[model samples]
Target: MGAQEDTALVRRGYEAFSAGDMDTLRELFTEDAVWHTGGTGALSGDKKGRDAILAYFGELYSRSNGSLKLTLEDVATGGRYTIGVQSGRADRDGKTLDQRTVIVFTISDDKVIEALEMAEDTAVASEFWS
Candidate 1:
C-alpha cells in the first residue's frame, strides 16, 4: 500500500504543482510534512506540517508577485520513492527568477510525509533562493 499510494501521490502532486494548484498539493501532504530550501533547508520539528508547508509557499509565491510556474520534465518511480526533474521560471518585474529544481518526494498512507527539493543548477538556484 505504501508504494502504490506513494506513486499516486507523487504523480498527482507534481501534476498539480505544474499547474500551480496549491490546493491539490496541500491535500497530499501530512500535517507534519517538511518543506525548505537555502539556509532554511529541510525544516524540522514544528516547521514540519501541512499548514507550515502551505504557509511557506504562500509567503514564497507572494514574494514572486504570483508569477510562479513549475513543470515536471521526468519522473522515476520505485518502491516508496520518486525523483523528478523540474523547470520553472518566476517573473515579477519583466525579469525571470531562476528556479530550476530537482524535487524528491516521499509518501506514506496516501499522504506526503517528506518533500525535498534542490536546485538543478546549484549556482543558479543559489542566486535565486536567497
Candidate 2:
C-alpha cells in the first residue's frame, strides 16, 4: 500500500472504532489481527480475525449502553506505525467505565496487523484486568 492508503486505513479504523462502527472495523483488519489491551478486562489478548473484532466491539457497545465513544487525543501515522490516544467512558447499568487508552497500531498492506493498548496507568490497567 502507498503512504496515503496506509494513513487512510489508520484514520478510518480509528474513526470507525470511535463511532462504534463494528462493520467498518471488520474490513480493516487481517484475518489474524491481534488486539492486546495489556490485560484490560474490557479488551485484551488476541481477538483473532474480523469475526472476533466484531464480537469484542459488540460486547463494548452492549456493555456501555451507547455511551461507549472514543475521542481521539492524538494520532500520528508513518509507514506501518500509527499511534493514537483516546479517552471514553464505557458506561453500563448507569455506571461509568473509564477507558482512557493510548493505542499503537502496526499496519501492513492497508490492514491493521497488530494493536497494543496502554491505559492511562499500568497500575490501573492491572487492577482492571485483575
Candidate 3:
C-alpha cells in the first residue's frame, strides 16, 4: 500500500479504538497479529494473535473501569510500517495514568500484523499502573 493508505489504516485503527468498536478494530488486524505493551507494569506484555490482543485490551479497560482512552496525535508511515503518536489516559485504584505513547505497526496487505507500544516515560507508566 502507498503511504497514504498505510497512514489511513492506522488512523482507522485509532478511530475504532477511540469509539470502543472492538469489532472494527479486529477487522483491521491480521488473524495472527501480535501486540506488545512497553514497561514492566500490569498491562505490559506480548499478546500474540488477534484474539489475545483483543483480550488484553479488554482487561486493560476493565482495570480502568472503562476509563482508559487513547487519542491519536499523529501518524507517519513508511514502507510497510506506521508509527502512531498518541496521548493516553486511564484511571484505576485511585491512580491515574497519563502519558504520551507511540505505537509502531507493521502492516501487510492492509492488515496490521504486529504492534509494539511504548510510553514516553516508562518509569512513570509503570508506577501509575502498578
Q: Candidate 1 at 56: error in angstroms?
A: 1.8
In candidate 3, residue 54 scores what lDDT?
Answer: 89
Lowest lDDT sum, 10 consecutive residues, model 3, at 121-130
- The sequence of per-residue lDDT tens digits that candidate 2 reaches over residues 24-101 is 888899889887766645455667676776787776677656667777776777766788778866655555557678
Let me know the TM-score candidate 2 reaches against the reference structure. Answer: 0.79
Q: Which candidate number has the best lDDT?
A: 3
Task: Please identify model 2 stretches exceeding 4 Å from their true place.
Answer: 2-4, 40-43, 122-130
**lDDT measured at residue 37 in model 3 versus the true structure, 0 to 100:** 89
lDDT of 1 by residue, 21-121 (tens): 88897788887787655433232223477888777677557766877777777777677567777878886545576656766777677787776777756
Measured with C-alpha atoms, the lDDT of residue 116 in candidate 2 is 81
Candidate 1 has an lDDT of 0.68
Best by TM-score: 3
RMSD of each: 3.4, 2.7, 1.2
Ranking by lDDT: 3, 2, 1
- Please report how far candidate 3 places residue 46 from its true position, in Å: 0.7
Model 1: residue 95 alpha-carbon error in angstroms: 4.1
lDDT of 3 by residue, 50-109 (tens): 999989878878888999999999999887679999999999888888889999999888
